[model samples]
Target chain A: MLDSRVLRVFREVFDDEQLAVSDTTSARDVPDWDSLAQVKLVIALEQEFDVRFSTTEIGTWACVGDLKRALRSKLGAA
Target chain B: MSAPAEIRVSLDWGGGEPMIVRWLVADRAPVKRGQAICEIEASKATADIVSPADGILVVVIPDGDVRDQEVVGHIHAVGEALPLSAAAVERGPEPDVEGGTHVPRSLRKAAEIRTLEEGRRGSLPSTVMQQLVVGDLVDRLRDGGASLTALVILAVARALRKHRAFNASASDTGVLLHDAVRIGVALDVEPHGLRVPIVTDADTKTVAEIAGDLQILLYKYMTKTLEPDEIRGATFTLTDLSSFGVAWSVPLLVGRQAAILGLGMIRGADPRDTMLTFSLTFDHRVASGREAALFLSDVRKRISEHMVSNDSGA
Candidate 1:
């Protein structure tokens, strides 16, 4: 359920329904997801989940899985 | 009903012939302008291709190397009878646009909006015209392996160097005078649109040097390989219509720059002595017509002197 919601955020940020977030997916997977897009994504995620991400935590995210883990930690659940 | 708009590609510098990685929207899906219609993978990285107009996306060259100025697809208006094949939708092979005069509706609308915006900004434009004998100058430029356009740019740059008032834009605080002479050269980038690629510190470059710089810019322009910074920030503009058979024209000032110079076609009563008309249009609020006249006269003097000069063309 968290994965689906996170996918929605990716789709909205990139303006592409074709965007697919898998365990292996990274910034290279989504075209035009540069530093600016990353900032936008972070903002959208914070608004979506009502959670703030630290700059240190954001840099640690290498893929969707990392992002989900961080989100889970903040939510206090798997 | 509005016609279908061609989605031409403008690849960023260093990203030529990028691979069409994937289509973000399905074929014939409704798309809004500014929407990411597809994703392209360049040599260095990837970029999203945004929709140029609001309509249904029709993909052509669906997958492969799509270079600059190449039509990858079209956006047909809603409820319009869509052409089943790419051949039916395309006006022709777009690279050969010199022979085709197809102005996509979206481009036309953009031009209209731009003209309206310029009007809204408002410029008190005034013009001063002069005719110069350009036969020898043309020969000199050819000998140097440069172009008449380069020579004209060189002259305008020199004149701007002497006349600081001509190289300024009006601001609420006061007239904003530029430190360097960056000249904007207008070239007809048909099918795509008119582009004014700038040559920075133009007054400092020799005629041949400017020619070499122009050649690189021309190549970049033709290949749609121009970087974003290649086409901005001009203190003055030089628009050449000499080849188009235009005898005379008063060019409108671009943005807030104080002046724009127009070069007309080479023509004369005696075949031995051909003359080019140079017209300077200035922002009257920032510069007087007398100053504009002096600036044009200076350009004519510089061009005429260079024509008969003994030194090998600069």
Candidate 2:
């Protein structure tokens, strides 16, 4: 299951209460998930998960599943 | 007064095809010196031809294709009548094209706007893209109740002050550098294409001041109340596509301006700071690739340093 905090962060970053994200959800799935919005999303995610991402990792994630896996790895490492 | 000064379409310094003439002022209209009388459109550039002397406008050619040094119209002194030989008076009205595909007025207007860029597409620009780390700047602005767009404008203006060559126009003599740093902020007017409102004398203003001006200009544009002056006189332009999730875009040059800067989406792994790509497309005729790179570097340095200074003060 996707972390409730991560889902909450997405909703907050997009400023949409109805936004739903699954493991397979990609940037194309969200209308407001643009470049500027993506930056806000990263900041929100860091605050929620208490994890930092590298530039290489930031550029590689393709969907929510990739993000979830990365988050899981970061948490495990911690 | 002396004979009316003939207004001619001068050949574009960066020579290309002849320009299409469209008069802004009508025949027999009283005009002031330096008033924008007509707009000349070539494939690469659209220039507003202004009146040289205060007088009455007498259009020799109401609307048609005109070549270099060809007399398009004249600015006559008061009491001077339209010459009988003036073709505008002779021609009753523009006839509708028969058997021609009927184009919507909106479509024709859109085509008119694209002609200038389409013409110059043949001469490809030298573009340089660099990823700027602007996390600290963005955070500082958010803390100070300032706008990120305004910060970018100030940075660009600062860089332009040092490198005037990037803020220049192509002239018959050479590249004519502008003394004033007017930065055009590209606003998507939506369904109507883009409308760029120029922030005049940006180099002289603070970030807060520039933000205030942009707020007023953007509101005017949204309300359809923007004046002609607000939309003209830009030496450089900035288009931020971050909101649209665009990572990078090669922005097109407006008019005869030397360069355009595009702000892409900001991304970062770390929450405290992020990286955004700044794409600059410049006229190779006015500046070389090295000069363009240096200008971007200067902008990046200025923004970084300014934000740091502001943070320490707070």
Model 1: per-residue Cα lDDT over B101-207, one tens digit each: 66654533444344324523667777889887665555545544556787778888888888998988876557888888888888774554577788887678877
Relative to the unseen true structure, what is the C-alpha lDDT of residue B109 in candidate 2, on a scale of 0 to 100? 45
Candidates' lDDT values, in order? 0.73, 0.73
Retained native contacts per candidate, as fractions?
0.00, 0.00
Q: Positional deviation of B11 in candidate 1, in angstroms?
A: 19
User: Each model's TM-score?
Assistant: 0.53, 0.55
DockQ of 2: 0.02
Residues B216-305, candidate 2: write the lDDT tens digits.
666566556676567766788899886567889987776667788999866666745567788998888778899999999998888777
Candidate 1 to native Cα RMSD, angstroms: 21.5
Tell me the spans in candidate 1 whose CA falls farther than 4 Å from its real position: A1-78, B1-104, B108-116, B311-314
Residue pairs that clash (backbone atoms under 3 angstroms), model 1? none
